[model samples]
Target chain A: MEIYELTVHELLEKLDKKEITKEEILASYQNRINEKEKDVQAFVTITEQEAKEEIKQKANNPSKLAGIPIGIKDNICTKGVKTTCASKMLENFVAPYDATVMEKINEAGMVSFGKLNMDEFAMGGSTEHSYFKKTKNPWNLNKVPGGSSGGSAAAVAAGMVPWALGSDTGGSIRQPASFCGIVGLKPTYGLVSRFGLVAFASSLDQIGTLTKDVKDSALLLNVIAGHDEKDSTSADREKEDYTKALKNDVKGLKIGVPKEYFGDGINTEVKEAIEKVIEKYRQLGATVEECSLDVADYALATYYIIACAEASSNLGRFDGIRYGYRTKNYENLKDIYRNSRSEGFGAEVKRRIILGTYVLSSGYYDAYYKKAQQVRTLVKNEYAKNFAKYDVILTPTASNVAFDIGSKINDPLEMYLADLCTVPVNIAGLPGISVPCGLNSEGMPIGFQLIGKPFAESTILNAAYTYEQNTDFRKNKPEFKN
Target chain B: MQVSKEEILHIAKLANLNLKEEEVDTYMGHLEEILNFANIVNKAPIDGLEETIGVNEAYNVFRKDEIIESLNRDELLQNAPEAQEGMFKIPKVIN
Candidate 1:
């Protein structure tokens, strides 16, 4: 196998044995990027110079991620690197300092290969909302690689990078990973620091990983998951070596299959694929049973209100004052703020901001924003009730496989439904992972998610790893050759 | 649930945005649909439920009030669209 195609674990073995050098692996990935990037358009900026510098100044006492090349989602701040959140507002914005996650990754010796693409400010489910370019699914160029981590998933699926970082607000990472046929994990909300992540919905957003398989997800998580003093929301708990969780055993594990996720809107093929996963788990000695989360039906409504409200507040800082794009013909300070934002933001972003402002506006706060917060509590309580009984909850990562570009972009409500299954996990601030389950007749991948209790990433990782090891799903890679 | 163009314009003003004349109609439709969908939250059985302000139980992450070195002013101003003497320059507010 090509060095670029190897998982982080496999590459590390080769590196330790002196069978391959960091330069060779970097070159192999660079070659893959050259071969496939035109077709995929998975990155906003490819940091080849930085990667080369990293390989040259290799650390003597190498960490597990030492010399490994990984793509960072555009929203994560990397000092001196262009950290555009796929938005024109910050097209020229170079981060002044590394985010907490970037600091951790740098300390672990991981090379920042590039800045992956996403929805503008991590807003949309399909990368079509990006101000730059749309990232096509590597599985089929005609389809989307789900967003706002679409570029991260596409890059990993296309073998352009071994693994990449993705941020999830409302199903961004796992949904795209499901569409692209890879492993994506949205860690527990407080599991990873969000100090440098450009805030979408501060309460719901999290930094995660998209990789070839479950073990790679665990490997990356081990490096990035920990409490940081910089982010107040970070959990002040003991950290675990997530790599040790890859035991590939699910015997006696209690898994709850949420029925709400399998309701009418889910595609038949996707439903059958998840059924197969449930059957496989049952066969592997797990106690699988149907469960109901009544509050899940309210997830979409709650998510939109809360996410938009927070987004509106978080994004208020980008008013052409401190940094980012500025309007040239502005006559006054208000004009500068108004015109710069109106011109810099894309349509979806604008829609969200307006919706958020409307929800939080006088006379409407109680009906929308406050109501959503109360519903959010019920959703959390429901998950907590289930987690008390089950080790993990299983569901399809998305309602269906990726749709054609422009198919649902015009229909905002339809686009929001794409996150029906995955959004509930984020709402509860739980760790969830999407692993490729099977392929549809159309040849697109179907994925099933395993969501664990808060800070119980190890449980879901074990379940996902067991399923991946027993099945040949991990062996299936998108045929990107054209 | 129908958001009028006037309301959209008002919301845009609140959001510090100046929507184009053409974009306003499209936004009105989009916002109406989103709000209609978001209205479902009102139907949720959330009686007596406390609002979840945040998922994390962590509160008041405190540290000693010690001074830490900050980012270099010159380096920080590198990405500013308009910078003057290590300060971000903006349009005049007081005329």
Candidate 2:
């Protein structure tokens, strides 16, 4: 098999046995990226030279990620590397410092492959909103790879990279992972530091991993998950070795299936796929039962209000004064601010900003913003109650498989509904993983999610790992040549 | 839920954005749809629930006031659209 097809664990085994050198693996991936990047369009920047240079420097203490070439979603700052969040606003903006995750990756001697593409500031469900280019699903070139971490998911699924870093606010990581047919984990908010992530929605944003299988997700999490003094919201707690949770045992585990997640909007094939996953878990000694989560009905509305409010405030930094794109001509200071932002931001971003400003405006605050916050509390309480009864909750990652590109881009509301199944977990600050369950009749991949309590990444990872070990889903890869 | 072009422009101004005349009508329809969807929050049974500012059990995280070296001023200004004397330059605000 080609080196590009190997997972991080498989590559590490080869490296430890001296069967392959780090340079060989990097070169193999570079060759694969060169061959398939045109078809997938999964990258905004390819740092082949930088990656080659970094692998030459041997590490003093090698970690599990040593010598692995990993792609970072463009929103994460990478010091001198250009960190554009798939927006023209920061097209030429190069960060002066690395994000906390990048710092950890650098210390572990992982080769930074390049910056991947996403929706502008992670504001959309499909990468069709990206100012640069839309990433196609590796499973079918005509379909979307999902977004705003579309490039990251497509890169991993296409075997262009072993694993990649992605950030999730409202299903950015999991949805794409589901569409791309891979394992994606959005750790509990505050579990990973958000110090240098280009803030879309500060309260809900989290850095996560999109990988070929569940084990790679845990290994990557081990390297990147920790508290940073720089990010105040970062949890000040002991870091767990996530890799230790991969025992492939699910005996006596209680998994809850929220009926609200499988309501009217879900596709028939997606429902069947999730049912098969539940039956497999039951056969493995897990007690899977259907449960009702009432607050889920209000989660999408709550997410829009809260996420957009935070986004409007956080994105105010790009006003043409300090950094990012500025207008060519402006009569006065106010003109510069207004013109730059209007010219810099795309349609979806501007729409969200306007909505946010309206909701937070004087008379509307109590009616919308405050009301959403109260509903958010209700959602959190519901998840807390469910966790107390079940070890993990199982749901479909998305309502359906990957849709054709441009199908839902025109209607923003239709696009927002794609996040229906995954947003509630983010609302409650819980960890969730999307693992490939089966494929639809269209041959597109379908994923089922396993959500765990706050700081219970180990629980969800164990459940996913057990299910993955018992099935051949993880072994499936897209045939790019076809 | 009924958003006029004037309200759309007003909201755009508040957001510090400039919209073209043609874009205003598009935004009006989109915003109206979004607001109608956002109305779902009002129907939620949140009559007596406490408002949550954040999901984490957060408190004021404090640290000792210690000086830490930051990025070089020149490196920071490298991406500025307009920079002069290590400072970002914009149109004169006070006239």
Q: Best candidate, lDDT-wise?
A: 2
Question: Which residue pairs show collisions in model 1?
Answer: none
Give the per-residue lDDT digits (tens) of candidate 2, residues A298-381: 999889999999998998999988899989878998888898998999999998998888899888999999999999899998
lDDT of 1 by residue, A165-184 (tens): 99999899999999999999
Per-structure clash totals for the candidates: 0, 0
* Model 2 alpha-carbon miss at residue A288, Å: 0.7
Worst 10 residues of 1 chain A by lDDT: A58-67
Give the poorly placed runs of model 1, Cα more than 4 Å off: A59-61
Q: Which residue pairs of candidate 2 clash?
A: none
* Residue A441 in model 2: lDDT: 87
**Reference-based lDDT, residue A185, model 2:** 98
Per-prediction DockQ comes to 0.84, 0.87
CAPRI-style grade of the A/B interface in model 1: high
lDDT for each of the candidates? 0.90, 0.91
After superposition on all C-alphas, the RMSD of every candidate to the true structure, in Å, is 1.2, 1.1
